[model samples]
Target chain A: MHGETAPPPTGPFADPALYTEITQFYAWHMALMDEGEPDAWADAYTEDAVFEEPGRTNVLRGREAIRASITKRTAELAAAGTVMRHWMSNLAVTPQPDGTLRATYYSLAMRAPRGERPDIFAHVVCRDALVREGERWLIRHRHVGIDALEK
Target chain B: MHGETAPPPTGPFADPALYTEITQFYAWHMALMDEGEPDAWADAYTEDAVFEEPGRTNVLRGREAIRASITKRTAELAAAGTVMRHWMSNLAVTPQPDGTLRATYYSLAMRAPRGERPDIFAHVVCRDALVREGERWLIRHRHVGIDALEK
Candidate 1:
């Protein structure tokens, strides 16, 4: 909840279409990431997007930077012969005056080794800012707060 | 994938408002359930709703039956001093000609014992049919398939 500095918009949010699109976007986005498609997964972000994971090192700026990180992670997971699934809960979307959207949700990064049951890798809260680009919405910013690491 | 008898509709889905409303519904629904609100949690279902979990015994029919189960589960979890969070993934919504909606999603039941780290309790796929009654959507039928119990 950004206070008076960036108070939320009051009027009714137009563009109900974004609700479906954004929600579906995430479902596809996470599915692709889990399926190990780095390029396609990172494509959901804008050219100048910012991705920050406070618990982890490095705050990646720009799509290429994010793509590189995704590529590295994909390779690491693949080499380990593991399956990772990202689960989301309590997704709330808010529309801003500048035609941007803020989406917040709880995420669980589940990890499953070959021939083993999946376990919780990380529990996190994600706050993402998205902009409409062409026919779809793209993430302009993402901040993930790790639940376990939180003080 | 139901074949023949209950084939999925192919054409574009009408009423995009439902996309936002139904997605938000689950967000609130799961939150209420996790917070141990039985009556409110069961209020999202129809009077004669059918709830089924193949791995678990008993196919509860009617809202009262579902409410009873929710109440019992809520008490049991509270008595054990545990916090249960349900996480969903890959949510897909389809609209039918009769104005009903079918939503399918992967769900993980995570259990946290007091301050301990959370663990996956059950991994499940839920196929639910929701119908509109006046102002809001209500669950008409829900069939949960447990991954671990699957043959």
Candidate 2:
């Protein structure tokens, strides 16, 4: 119901202000994780944000729940002590008519244990996200699918 | 050397036609793969393209080599009979004074058997691309890293 603002003639895709703000959010969002802090991930989304994957029936709702999920994953991955580096690129920001923004990005994540060929795990995607809450954007909903999924 | 088309009063991060061309490139580039053509991948890049992965010296140089590399990868993965889908989203298009667009995208690629919890691959950043050949945007250089590499 927060669609009061008349939709901009052009979506955020062509707006530098909105585009840069959202892009910076992405960089900061990852930096928090890069420093091994999952709590920040929870705070990044809105209070009523929704996180969904392909198979998981339990949609992570609310900021607290979102934090819990990320924390659990972080704990498990931290045990291995493998340095995780995320390289995000090929991003497209589109503005919806409702004055919100939707974006798609390509990401390549690599993991290594101090040193190691078979160490590359890449996920490329067309992620669709809704941005709201004024200039402050939070991912309202996300649908994640892998590049190589069995049909 | 390609900075001849610099505008008189260009604002920061403002480029409509440039982004349009770039976005079109991304859309069609992904579609080419959806068509299941490996050669198309190579042709999508410049004659001198560089594909680099973290902690690896396996840089494939030139169009022919790049094509061969992609062909080998496709052939190897095809043996598993798994379907591959590349989804690119959250694109940040930055136009340089040199007439080339710098784009950053976040990506998620999933791989698995039909109706299963596919292995989730997260690519953090895929960057360093150049668009040349007039209205044709091909990846000149690509650098990719992973998020959950060890997990």
Candidate 3:
């Protein structure tokens, strides 16, 4: 029931403040992950969130599970001396009838061997269901679809 | 100057009508391409639009060139007896300061030989700058990034 603000008369189509919040959500999420703060990154999700990668049959439900999965991945990457950066773009947010926001964006995962030129390892399109908790938008469900399969 | 409609007091954050229009834009674009209506698909772009697929060095500017490129690709697919379907998801649309909209989505292209189980051929994240031409939203610039490289 946070819909008291009147929309602008012209110019941008969406509420500028709402848009800024969503964009910042992604930016902060990425920064947390890249900085090796798995727990902090996972805090962006709701307690009962569902995380899935359809192409890989990876599904982790609940915030604790999600955090564990990311932590394990981070450890593996660190052990291999590979640094990964995820670049997300082309984000679209939609308001659903059920009082939730659906967000979609494309992600490019670039990986390097410590000090090498990063090569694109994965290109993914992500769909997220987000809910507002207090003043923050936390993810409730996230689905990632990978573009191509390797040999 | 198209922003006169007031947003709903509750439910989704985006203007429902604008969200519908943007989603339908993608639906129509995909349908036109899948149905072999290249001209109609190309019409979705502005006269001076830029279409780029950096992974393939494919940059087609202008509506006519964009049309030609799609037409050629359609013919080649037809000749090879491949029926391709492009599935787009995770679509996010943002209103820019320049009175244009930026749309980002994920696309998964599936291809099959007439009667085979379609296999994923490509995954892409697309970022589009769209302009409103009368009542329709048209692409002003499009960038497609592929997910993976081939061996």
Candidate 4:
């Protein structure tokens, strides 16, 4: 293993390089989404991707659907002078035998209004299926589950 | 430089290994502090560490002093049914010529009350000097500045 994480390392997780890459990916990827760049954010996913939000009965399939959904949401937030930041913690990544990564993390969605303090909009547990192509890793599927629906 | 962090990297920051170590160190270290283990949290720092919170006029010198401070605060928080979690983002780790790491990150201090949603208690910029001992990285000096005083 690598770093100080608790582990009996297995598969791709054993490589510290993979660990660093995955963490950096989300850190960069989340900022694009939070900053209202739907095209850039959606490009991080595969062309045929599945996005699931069971609490809202929103299971959007395909990259175009994901891009369109976020574009609409970000436009509304921009008009309202609000910014959403997603904080990911306690990440656990496992490499599946089928050559995909099963990554899970606790996500905190913080909503900050212009010139105002931020609050937790939602607390979610996110699981992602990632596929590697060339040197880039793309999200093939994302399943987001909320604890205690905010709405 | 490795991973997907914004470029041009230098020194230890260019080493993906160091990046992994520093990130993992904080992720593990913060949990110990947030979980109310003052001793464990303080032990992550050097014995002669300096902790500074300029806005609060609290400049603690030495690990024992740091432990004492957190212990008191954590006790109060536990009695009042509160938990404080620090979410770090946009980390920048630079290696000084003196063989120490100059690390900086944006910290979101989230305050959670019992059975209630958490909110941002404070948004602070934290900078730390880290020294490596064998495979362990310990905090030598930490200076935290608040963007806007919450109180």
Candidate 5:
């Protein structure tokens, strides 16, 4: 199951390997973010990546803009020194026959800034992604929704 | 890759394959719900599954109770003929050496009942799952937080 294409998978997806690859892609990306480099998190996406969060009319676009946004978040986290851990589940990876992959998953980020107990900061939106560019899959677009963002 | 557990490669996880299996498990489970089978959706979880919606203090537990709650929801959907689709992404799956999988993913579910413009229904809190059982993974526990829920 390494690099070689498998048989045609049934039920809306062709490649099962795509699912494994995209899932691994996310695991690696998030791990980088958790390592405290938000810039690396933002850089994991395409240069023209469009990032959106809930309750904000503005959609941050491009690598620089995305980096700026992440930098601001990192700054905030640095000030608070909160240990935030993101939890994700229920990922839906749908594969297109053309070898491209589209996936969605559910996530929760538990933010425990300082000495406070960890609280559920955001119920988030897991957006669809296009995975290509040889072996490495980068997120092309992302839109995050806040299910509940109350402090 | 269909059952090939070759020592479980390491990537911030002791059993990465469990993560993938659990992800697909939830995917297949939710897909059953989207296909209008809420009974199966409720049945997919364990007897002690937990479900919580933000802003409401009530928590749903147990298989029968969960089924009842889902049945109620299904009844509403049946009456409304609402078509719901959950998009999930950003899955980070970390497997403990013990084989229990801790995973997270972000999700967005849009509901379009009776042809109205699809509205973002829930920005959700997705938590890590404990996947047990030999090849198939089940959501042993699930905690949901609503960052935003459709009014």
Candidate 6:
């Protein structure tokens, strides 16, 4: 029972243009990360954003901390000569009453070592709360859960 | 890359009321299943609905088949006196160009014996294509994926 706290009926993303823009925002976020642009990736989040992985109990608050975490992971992969690609699909966007957007998407991470075939390294569902400051939509909170850990 | 085939900007669910209605539909669908109503659960899908679990390669087509599958599973659980609770969160709904709605959500299934503590049994992401035939939205195609299976 979700208990009556449904999202708002319509907000900024109700408009087609804004919806497309939000989608592109996610696309660009992924592109920037894949291109090793950590600074740009961190810029995608709000100054006080919160990133959490519930399964691992890993939480990073604020844009600077999030940036450092991603940078460190990307550097580790690069140093090991590993190629990583993140594929996201089944995205759904909803408008919140407080003028924020709630975006949920499925992500699959494929990793390969130099010349080896790519293999699925992780699969997760990401729930993101996004806000628009000025003309840009930034992530306010992101919660990720890894799937099928229990037998 | 999603490759140019993006979801429609607006459709029946573009209206706030309709969006809320569709969300309620899912709520009721889950409630019906939890209440051991197999016939009602089958009614949630269209006559020619397709239910697929891609990770397990399990596919059930048509309403009757889907119903039978649910009925069978429920019966087995009942026979063992086990209780199953499905918790869904981070739901996102998108309207399709052909008048269908694409609903994506994360599901965590918890199970336990009649008098024991519940434990998570499965975690999955569900992508469903919903259609409105006569003022009611029903699922036309559902694709489910379990996380982190491939390595």
* A124: Cα error in model 6, Å: 0.5
Ranked by lDDT, the better of candidates 2 and 4 is 4
lDDT of 6 by residue, A67-124 (tens): 9999998898888888877766545577887889888765656677777876656656
Report residue B115 deviation for candidate 1 (angstroms): 3.6
Share of real contacts kept by model 3? Answer: 0.00
In the range A1-151, model 1's lDDT, one tens digit per residue, is: 1223432222233346666666678889999999999999999999999999884759999999999999999999999999999977778687888989998777887788988986777777689999988888899999986544312
Flag regions of model 5 displaced more than 4 Å. Answer: A1-16, B1-23, B31-69, B74-151
TM-score of each: 0.59, 0.53, 0.59, 0.61, 0.55, 0.57
Native A-B contacts reproduced, model 4: 0.13
Q: Global lDDT of each model?
A: 0.80, 0.64, 0.74, 0.79, 0.66, 0.73
lDDT by residue for model 6 over B1-151, one digit each (tens)? 3547977664544465555555446645664675577777787688899999975757998988998898998898888876655657777788777878888888766554543434557888999999876545778999988873423
> Higher-DockQ candidate among 3 and 4?
4
Residue pairs whose backbone atoms clash in candidate 3: A90-B104, A91-B92, A92-B92, A92-B93, A93-B92, A104-B90, A147-B123
Question: Ten consecutive residues with minimal summed lDDT in candidate 2 chain A?
Answer: A1-10
Instruction: Give residue B4's lDDT in candidate 6 (0 to 100).
Output: 72
The DockQ-based CAPRI class assigned to model 5 is incorrect
| Model 5 C-alpha lDDT per residue in residues A1-151, reported as the tens digit of each score | 1112422222443244666666577777777766688877886788887777757548888878888877787788777787777766666777667865667666667677667776655555477667577656777777775544444
Q: What is each candidate's DockQ, to 2 decimals?
A: 0.15, 0.10, 0.02, 0.13, 0.12, 0.09
**C-alpha lDDT (0 to 100) for residue A2 of candidate 4:** 23
DockQ versus reference, model 1: 0.15
Superposed on the true interface residues, model 6 gives a C-alpha RMSD in angstroms of 10.3
Candidate 2, which CAPRI tier?
A: incorrect
User: What is candidate 4's lDDT per residue for B1-100, written digit by digit as tens?
Assistant: 4778867555444377676667667766776767677767877888899999987857999988988898888899889877676778888999888889
Error of 5 at A111 (Å): 0.6
Order the candidates by lDDT, highest first.
1, 4, 3, 6, 5, 2
Chain B, candidate 5: TM? 0.80
